[model samples]
Target chain A: MTFFEAENVSKNYAGHTALDHVSINVKEQSIFGLLGPNGAGKTTLIRIINQIIGPDTGELRIKGEKLNPDHIAQIGYLPEERGLYKKMKVGEQAMYLARLKGLSKQDAYSRLKKWFEKFEIENWWGKKVEELSKGMAQKVQFIVTVVHEPSLLIFDEPFSGFDPINAELLKQEILKLKDKGATIIFSTHNMSSVEELCDNIALIDKAKVILDGEMQSIKQEYKSNAYELKVRDLQKDINEILPSSFNLKKIRALNNCQSFVVELPGNVTSNELLSQVMPHAQVSSFEEILPTMNEIFIRKVTEAGRSK
Target chain B: MNKIFTILRREYLSRVKKKSFIIMTVLGPILMAALFVVPVYLANVSDREMKVAVLDETGLFYDAFHNSDKVEYENIYMDYATARDQFEELDYDALLHIPESALNNPNSVKLLSTSNIGLNMISDMESVIQKKLEAHRLSLSGIDKKVLEDIEVDVTINTFIYKEGEEKQNYSEISYALGLISGLLIYIFIFLYGAQVMRGVIEEKTSRIVEVIVSSVKPFQLMMGKIVGIALVGLTQFVLWVILTGLIVFTFQTINPDLFKYKSPEQQMIENKGLTPDELAVQQENLELSNDKANSLLEGIRQIQFGNILIMFLFYFIGGYLLYASLFAAIGSAVDNETDTQQFMLPVTIPLILAIISMQVVLNNPDGPVAFWMSIIPFTSPIIMMARIPFNPPVAYWEIGLSLAMLVAGFVFTTWLAARIYRTGILMYGKKASFRELFKWIRF
Candidate 1:
């Protein structure tokens, strides 16, 4: 059974629909990426799940039970709008927030110590939050959100303000938490991060989910008739030998070496094209390259825009 | 384990550690006491010395305005033009010219000074003129001046009470004083602490911390936690301040006993003016009677069944603070920002101000409908009732019980309203919300 499921959720904020009959399932121990561009109801959906705002009509089931107060204790949420007591000390503020999440003082302190040490921020305990750098404060915020070790974690742009090294470090911790059987819901526009970490992906656009499935399957579903082929330039121009049935999408050449994304007829295979083109140039490498997540994201959003 | 208690502890500790809280708490009472006492202390020592040139054309007030340390009169015959010419050079503070036959026309006399003269100086001259004029009347009458001085009235203040048995005196003066102090303190603490709650909410809301905390705890818990925390902070500071102020005042009095001395010869003369041995004796007898009456009135109040007004003061103080603090929190949360807060602040603040204004009236006449209603109103009662409790309250125990219950009920209801608004307002960004939207949010 799914750890969390929302069935036919709908919400309207002052007659403007933010979520229109949205539904999704989050399996336990899975990294489910809620992907969308700016203003795409991704945050609206996340807020509904966290119960920060109520859905107009829906049933939000957590661990096969209706979502309520007790479910909040098992879920940790890091809001996109980062907030902390600017005047309070780092550890003091963290402890207060941790307690609010239902962690006892002893348990919170013990967990904070480990998280702080692991994040190499143990020395930051005495520093006031306002005195810390943005990245440093983000680390503290990250610690507070996860200190209680909730079973379900929702992070909205959690890697924002984090440098690449720190972002990678956070990614490892998130994956480790998943390995320990925590269901994680991550929302971001960074398709690379989603591609690196997510097992399942849901793309939301204009208050509706346009696509939702396993990450690999969704990527396959959104593929275009494109491939990347790298070749040695034996013949000066490889395009001269290509049949009129083939469509050359793009080509790049440097230092007597060339690479291209080719669109072939549906009846033709890569071997047939390679056999025909081999005599024109000594092929260095030939393989079908799938589109990057960034390309797929832009394509799908543009497609949705055109459809509307 | 106890969530509310946990919130309270955190708030208490955090606020107590702040430097602003520490400074204000410890020094606030001393500063307040100084504001009251310093002026009184200064009034006694501040200059009674004002140099004056008296032109006594009538020759009647030469000795009327006798030389004293407070007013040193120097005789001068300079005309108006000459007095003006040497006004600054003559080293005179003021020139008092009583025109001829001024008693027949008191308005004809004029004072010339480089700047505005003190009212006391002008009033002193009038008083001396009136006494001399009255003395002239006595001389024309059959009685001599000495005989006229001996004629005095001895009035006694008596008290009659309708208690369980006999007619007992009431210590109305001390009771009024005690009542005023308790009531005023409650008024001040409620205002100070309630405003502190307002500022605390604004601070959190401005800092955006409310948004994050609201997601975890219910908005009601967050608002209650802040209200209770700030009250504890106020209470903690109040205790520290009481101790510190007492110590500072005790030290000042002990180390500088001369500062309090009012035994100077001028002070003695001022105390003993216009009285003979017989008149003095009569005055003393009347004073003793009034003092006895005052003391007995005090004893009557002390003997009444209420255990201690101080305890009631504390209960009503906490109750009043909680009641007002919640209202302040509600107002604080209603607006997303401070500027918008003003639109709602008036209605929230007027009740507190009214409670203070009505507190004395309640003390003077506790059994009156005004006091009874103010005490039971829940808004004014915390202060009004506390003030009147020192005075004899003619009411059943149920009134007190009912007032307390209503205060609790009022707090619970208002807290829910504040929490509902807070939950919606905290996360709302950018757009401004109206009263209609906020009221609608409560329905959700």
Candidate 2:
């Protein structure tokens, strides 16, 4: 089910379009990635979802209800530019933000305590935000964003300032949140994290979505007919054994095996290529090579740029 | 409403808990009390004694100079060079050199001092010489100096203000002081509290906390909460200052009862010393005169309608602060930093500064056209009306009512515009917003 949706949303700032006819749906209890280069309207769309800015023309619905101020309580937003009152104590600032997100004072305190303990930052409660390291402050902000347990959580570049260890911790926490039936809208340029965590994605470029679908299906849709085969046969004439539809791109010899990259013509299946290569050499392993999300992102953005 | 309260609570608590706020709150009343009491206390504390050597070449005035606690006079007959030498050797504060020609031209009488002599000392010396000269001239003309001295007259004017059906006493001096004070207080409170609202906005924007808070609460709610919260802070500080200053003043008054007395300390000292019957009678008459002055001052204070003034004061105080604070908040929202605020701040502050500048005119002629128009205009009424209130100006009820209504309308309009600018500006980064951009945000 669609947990949140922005339909044909358009936003203009002083005659400049920030979001132009942009549309995306985030599924329930899943990690939805909002992928875009800088100024690709990703932040604008996220802000629209948070209702920080209203769309000039569009409909925004949360859980099948028209978006209103009432929905603010159900949405958690950690903006791209992370901010906390530097003079405020970490625990107090977190609790204040949690209360602002509609948590009772007692509830905010208890939840924040649990999160602080979970993150092993129980001692930082009394420390001011400015006294904390940037990564520690980011941890505090992350806790503040989720302490209220909003059903739909939006994180814009959530891992930008985190060390690798904390990034792993945050990734685990995000998955934990999704496991607890929370729908997450994760926006970032970090493709590795997207590939590791996101179930669906919408790649926006220049105020428009150029590619969007289930992460697996989008990767599948972008795959060229290519295969990586490991065969222990330098003795065989590999080119003569290969079918006319298969083009051998590169062959490398390992210590015990020869690795070959083969591209098949359209309408040709990997199984047929594997069968054609099986007779002349000992086929030890065979695997399909799909493009990485990074490559796909670059290609899609460049293609959209060219078309523009 | 609950969200607004939440924001207000945070704004208030965070600020009230600040070290700077606490320091200012504690120091403000002490400073105000000092401003009122210190000058009076210092005036009552007598200055150090000064010794003067008078070279009287005209021996006729030798006995005219007498000794007092603050000044001692010694008659010395010597040449100018010898007197100057003796003056330095004796460490005298000054030498009063009366040349032989001084009997013809009094201006030739020169006073030489090692340092800058007090004006009071110079004036006293002049008066003594003038009195003795006058006596000498009168005697030479064969007239009795005592008779001329005794022929003294005192004139007092009893003013009664005639109103609709009754006549009441009027004290212009006391009323003028009250008007000036109340008007000045309003001006100070507005500037103090309005700047607080602006600073609060800039702090939130610069710290980048506005975006996070506004995501949960409307920008309008945030701005209103901040303005009202800082207003409460201002009112709290003002009340504390009033109470503290009153206590300090009362303590000082109790400790030195003569500090605020009408008579100078020298006169009070003379009355305390042994005196002949004639001198005693003169002291008694002076005391009676001071008693009458004190009574009249008390009566003037009693005639003021403090209850009405208090009510109107609070009304205008809040109305004026709200009107100006909204504009200040708008200026704050339209700028990226305090430096950028100057361009917008000038326009908002001009009217308030104008109100203060025009306060004297309002006080001098509370019923004149300038005062009437200034008190009726919403921008200037808060100060001018308070000033005119003490004068019992014939301001119609409808004029005050309309002025207040217009102030309320102005507040609403400015707050709406401020909210529009604030919502757009808080999230905006890097760009220095100009007037044109602010107008566009209002349209947005």
Candidate 3:
């Protein structure tokens, strides 16, 4: 079931359109990546979903019901510019934010205690946020965003200030949240993480969604039907042996091994290309090259830009 | 509603728990009480007796210089040079030289002292010499000095204010002081607490916590919560100040009751006397003629309606603060930092500053056109009305009712405007907002 959806949502600020007739749907218990460049309407769309802003012309639904203030309790948002009261104690600030999200005081305290312990940060609860390092404060803010166990969690650029280890830890935590049946909308410029974590993604560019689908299918749709072949025989000429249906893109020699990249025509399958190249050389390895999410993001955004 | 409470609780608790807030709350009343009591204590404690030597070469004013509680005068029989040399030996604070120019050119009288002589001593000596010279000239002109003294007449006016079919004595001095104080207190409370609200908003905005809070609660709720929370802090401080100031003033008064005593010596003497009815009546009349000045001042203080002033003072204080603080909050949200707030602050503070500047005019003519218009206008009425209320002016009930209604309306309008500016401005950064931009936010 679609846990959250925005139908033809548009937002205008001053004379500029921030979001122009954008629609997105997130499946239950899945991580939906919102990919966009700087100045795109990704943040605006996320804000609309959180109801921090109202769309100029559209409606939002949560759990197949019309959105209202009551839905705020079920949504948690961590904005791109992360913030916390610098002079406030960590535990108290967390509890206050959780209560603001509609959790009981006792429940907030108990849940925060567990989260703090799980993160091994129980000792820092009494410290002021200003005294904490940027990464530490980000962790505290991350804890605050999910402490209430909202059904839909929106994190904008959640991994920007984190180190590699902390980013891995956060990735684990996000996966754990998804396992616990929370629908997540993650927005970032980092595409590698989207490949690792996102089940589905919608690429927004220039206030419009240019590409969106399940992560596997979007990468598959952008693939060039290319394959990397490692052959031991350096004596065979790859250009002459390849059929007219296939184009040999490159042939490189590494030590005693020769590897060639071959692209198949649209009508040709990967198996056909593999079989066609097998007799030309001693094919030790044959692997189809699928495009990375990063390649797909860059290619699609540039293509959209060029088209416009 | 619950989210607003959460924000309110956070704002109040974080501020009230600050060490600075506690220190100010405790220190404010002590400083205020000291302002009232210290000057009185200093005046009483610094009264030391001074001694003067009078070298009268003319010998015409030997007995004119009399001793009082604050000064002692002794006549010296010596030349000017001998008197000057003996002045230090005599330990005199000053030496008064009455040069003989055939008792003419009174302005040429010289007073020499080792150090600066007190103005009180100089005036006293001048008056003594003038009185004796006047009597001397009167006798030489063939007119009896007693006839000139008998022609002297003292005039006094007793003021009564007739209101609601009753005669109420009016005390302009006491009421003026109370009016000035009430008006000044409201001015101070509004400025002090309004800036506090502005500073609180700036802190939250600059810290970037506003977006976090606004996401959970509406921007309007967050602004209202902060405004109300700081107002409660102001009220808490004020209540503490009133109680502490009262306690301090009461303790000081109880410890030094004589410090505030306004009784004249003649009244004290009459109370101690026992006389026949005929003598008593004559003495009583003389006492009234001699000491009515002191009694009239005390009576004037007794005639003021303190209870009425207190009630109106509190009402205007809260109303004025609410009206100004909302505007201050709006200015705070429109800026990136404190320095950027100057342009917005001037417009918001001008009306309050104008109210204070016109307080004196309102106090003088509580029923005049300026006072009437100022007291009727919502922006100025908080202070001007408090000033006028103490004077027992013939202000109609509906004027006050209308003024209060307008003040509430003003607060509501400003709060609505502030919320609009705050919602958009909180998320904006690194831009100096113009009035045009602020108005745009209001439209948005």
Return whichever of 1 and 2 wins on TM-score. Answer: 2
lDDT of 1 by residue, A1-308 (tens): 48888888888876588888888899989999998888888888887777777888988998889988777778888878776788889999898889888888899999999999999989999989888998898888888888888899999998999999999988998999999999999999888899999988888888888888888887777666556778885675656788878899888876778888888887788888888888888788887767777887888889999998
- Give the share of true interchain contacts found in each model: 0.44, 0.58, 0.65
Counting only residues 3 or more apart in sequence or on different chains, how many pairs clash (N, Cα, C under 3 Å) in candidate 3? 0
lDDT of 2: 0.85
Tens-digit lDDT track of model 2 for B1-444? 888888888888888898988898889888988998988776666678988889888777777776767788887778988878777787888889888888778888889888988888789899989988888778888988657856865667868878887888778888789889899999998988898889888888887778778778888888999888888887777777778888988998898888877654336545454455775676577667767877998898998888888788889989899988988888787777888888888888788789889888878888889888888778888999998888753467887898889888878887888888888888887778888999999998
lDDT of 2 by residue, A17-91 (tens): 888898899999999999999998998898888888889999999888999989898888888886788889998
- What is the fnat score of candidate 2? 0.58
Can you write out model 1's per-residue Cα lDDT over B284-348, one digit (the tens) per residue?
66566666655665577567545566567667878888877877876676666678777677887
Which residue window of length 10 is worst by lDDT in model 2 chain A?
A: A232-241
TM-score quality measure for candidate 1 = 0.79
**DockQ of each candidate, alpha-carbon based:** 0.45, 0.62, 0.67
What TM value does model 2 have? Answer: 0.88
Which parts of model 3 are misplaced by more than 4 Å?
A: A236-253, A275-280, B46-48, B86-94, B105-117, B142-144, B153-156, B263-291
Error of 1 at A88 (Å): 1.1
Mark the regions of model 2 whose C-alpha exceeds 4 Å error after superposition: A231-260, A275-284, B48-59, B62-69, B72-101, B105-119, B135-160, B173-178, B264-302, B305-310
- Model 1 pairs whose backbones collide: B170-B297, B171-B297, B171-B298
Q: For each of the candidates, give the backbone clash count.
A: 3, 0, 0
Higher TM-score: candidate 1 or 3? 3
